[model samples]
Target: MAIMAGPGDPVLAETAAERIRELMDGGFVVDADGQHAPVHADDLAVISPHVEQASAIAARLADVPGVLIGTANHMHGLEREAVVVIHPLVGYREAPACATGLGRLCVALSRHRAYATVIVDADADLVLAHAQREAPRDARLATQRHVLAALLALG
Candidate 1:
């Protein structure tokens, strides 16, 4: 699976790592190395646009047992069954270009065949709007409310 931490939100990545570790402990197998085996440190990939953020997340997840840290470039040609994208919303008035770029990145990242793509961001509404606009017809939208409700139920 792939997890994309925000440009400056290392905590989000750390939390995700914790959740992933918990899931792993509960028998969630990720990228079984083509043998349906258990996940190893090399199976999970953490991606971010900023090298520093990516590196930080990598370091935080270093002891997770089998997770790997990498830049967004690593996603090319690879298939991830699950992905978590942590995007920070840039106000359009502050920097339209940057906002557009991040939105494009989010859309591109969501195009993969991952069974689940969890995007955590304060501006999730904007991100989801952009993603839905560019998503394929088969894609379905899952709002944060729905996700939170599910998590609550599980709890």
Candidate 2:
């Protein structure tokens, strides 16, 4: 599920941390050999595009045992029962090249084995649209925009 926050929202890390706690407390379930099983805190991961945000999330979740917290890059090739991704461009008016890269978002969203939650800015579509309009010929940005659009549409 996608959680939309206001632009320049400074609490995504905190929100992610809280979500992990909720999932843990609420007995997050996962498919285990076609059977349902409760997920442990260690089975969850929180990923962000920025290290600063990652660090903040880690700090908040430090007491929660077994929850992995790191940047999207760190999550590559890893899988968890649940994952919460902090949108890279959540607070940006313009999409930065690094954040708009497809690999990062793909990794963050795909790392989850069962459940995935994305925390994005409420106006992410608008920001991406403006970025795409500004660089219509940029194939990479267009692809990223399309991918994000598809993701958002799922909700």
- Candidate 1, residue 149: lDDT: 39
Question: lDDT tens string, model 2, 1-155?
Answer: 23344332447877898889888878657464677666788889998888878887888888887898898888879998889988777877678887788788888889988788888766667778888888889888788777778778976
On lDDT, the leading prediction is 2
Write the residue-wise lDDT of candidate 1 on 6-120 in tens digits.
Answer: 3465565566566556545653453436545554444455545555655777677766755545445555555444444433332111222343354345543553344333434
* lDDT values, one for every candidate: 0.47, 0.79
What TM-score would you give candidate 2 relative to the actual structure?
Answer: 0.87
Candidate 2: Cα lDDT at 84: 91
TM per prediction: 0.53, 0.87
CA error at residue 92 for candidate 2, angstroms: 0.9
lDDT of 1 at 4: 42
Candidate 1 Cα outliers beyond 4 Å, as residue runs: 1-6, 30-37, 88-99, 102-114, 124-155
Question: How many residue pairs clash in all the candidates, one count each?
Answer: 3, 1
RMSD of each: 7.9, 2.9
**Candidate 2 regions off by >4 Å?**
1-9, 31-33
